[model samples]
Target: MNNPEEKEITFVMPFGPQHPASGHFNAMITCAGENVVDLKAYPGYLHRGFEKLMEYRTHVQNTMLSDRVCILDPFSNEMAYVHAAEISSGVEAPERAKYIRAIMAELGRILSHLTWIGIMSSALGLESGAKIAWGDREKIIRLNEVITGGRLYPCYFMPGGVRDDITGDMAGEISRVLDTLEDKGKLYDDFVFFNTTFTTRTNGIGVINAEDAVALGATGPTLRATGMGSDVRKDEPYDAYPCVDLEIVTMEKGDAYSRSMVRRGEIAASISLIRQLLQKMPAGDFKVKWPMTKKVPPGETYFCCEAARGELCFHMVSDGTDKPYRVKIRGPSFSLALAVFPYLSRGVQIADIPAIYWSLDPCPADMDR
Candidate 1:
């Protein structure tokens, strides 16, 4: 023991790679008693180096490889990669295909956000909320199976268009699932969002203003929670987004509660977008039909899409061959995990760490890739 006038001793603790609440990522947290003074993320437990792997695989194979980038969000990863390949090869997806892609992508957003809700709720000790969200998420995954013949890694998206088209019965099934999820949203509000315990833990915690959020490269719901209203879908429209009406949901507070609210509002918005897309879907070929060994022209292209997390971008260079010369991926979680988490974690209580960490909804696979 030292004199009372002496400086307080700080301790560093490793808070991940095994902690159920840590989400498979490690954080080296320096704390003075119960308060955190600093924290640094240590990712790469799930790294597959997907960018370099894509360079070795053929363009068609890369679509499957991209799914591993974010298994919880495989559709967005495949869509972004295929869009880059299509741009380099001068191929345009059909109008009907674009509508179908948009529908699937929005469904994918709902699926991913539901998973987030489950994981985040579980981290907060709200086991009932986790089960409710995950049960609803299963509906979307089953829909993926019906449409693409695969559950987790659908691999349905291709360079020019999707491998299959949505049938009339599939559309009805989708509508039914959407209706079920919309009805279940109220339970989430009652049991989780409006709970006194949750509000007490989240409100006024991990606050980051709009300017600081942008300066730190935050996006998607994280940035939107700060009232920035910046989204790739609105800033740079792609696929069926240009044709559909989208509302960029935002909240004035930049705390964990605000982030959760933004995503909750987005779930409703995505459901609305999908209904519109299905209504406007045209009758035509869903794909241009290219061979798996098709070669792209010598060109470099950068394509990005508004993934469930944020902006997921891919840069591709082709030397007039089936294999890409170079491929680089920019995932939103990199900044959110490595930069924003640490910035907001300072001066917060050790117990509040989980609330802040999961608020940004960082994916270990996205950051490690």
Candidate 2:
């Protein structure tokens, strides 16, 4: 029962700023006949000018701002920036400090992946999965608070070492939290992965081939979904990664389903890493003694870390001053956001755009910063 004389009118829909699920930004989609013709992402609504602001602040002061780059994975920024300063000034962290850094980094990874899984489930209308994912995330947040005295933005990593030491009680608490999460993780997998509706909605949707993924500069789980095993933790071992065993998780199908599965697998791996780190942690000075003046020599240094999103690189040029001469934060979210827009607009319904967008896990603040 179709009308021969009827015509479809294309319209643009704005989804953002105050939507139920569009985290931290707004997205506009132009649709014609149920298919999205174009999509534009606006992220300046909360621009804080982090890069330019870092140039005006001292190296120590910049650590506070780095955490705001990606609110979910703030520790990764802390480690990356501190490591950059450490490398530039030829100051190597002690053995115990390196182990502590690894623990914090892995814990941050678990928390970030959990948040993404929860948000994605909510986007797909899987309310039960979202609840379970976020509830378990609370345990990880508690552990972060126990170690660094801060839940979201710890700022615990200094130039040469950590801000405080992880004592016996803190280590035991982390182990107990991991045990609880392991039990909860199994139930979550059964509810989400085994559910027919969840699979039908996500499987084979927003498919990206290996070649396309590589050409578009995709990294982390997005690249791993295409069967590429390129993780900075494995390729370039930094801090305590060399002391512990590590594994890379990858999937053959580069689709929404594959990306979600890869993230789940990474969460499991991060838990294993944390448990091992706690058991074999050494005893030493938590903080290295540095000059009170806090001056870094004149030089340019490049440092990269495997953030929860992807590879986060920091290129800093110092002029023997307290503040940096130039600082550039190469966030992986920027590249992933660009790759998603072009591929998501054509031949897909407007309803599917949210799934595709969430699969990319684009942090708008990271992109605009």
Best of the candidates, lDDT: 1
Q: What is the TM-score of each candidate against the true structure?
A: 0.97, 0.97
lDDT of 2 by residue, 54-157 (tens): 88888778888898899889988998898998888889888888889999999999999988878888888888888988998899898888899999999888
Model 2 vs. true fold: TM: 0.97
Tell me the deviation in Å of residue 185 in model 1: 1.7
How well is each residue in 1-369 modelled by candidate 1, as lDDT tens digits? 768898877999988988476767999999998999999889989888888988888988999999889988988999899899998988999999899988999999999999989988887888898999999999999999999999999999988899998986999999999999899888999888887767888999999998998888888899999998788888989888999999999999899999999989999999999999999999998999778889889989898898988889998899998999999998989889998999999999999999999989999989998
RMSD of 1: 1.7
| Model 1 C-alpha lDDT versus the unseen true structure | 0.91
Candidate 1 TM-score to native:
0.97
Please give the CA lDDT of all the candidate structures: 0.91, 0.85
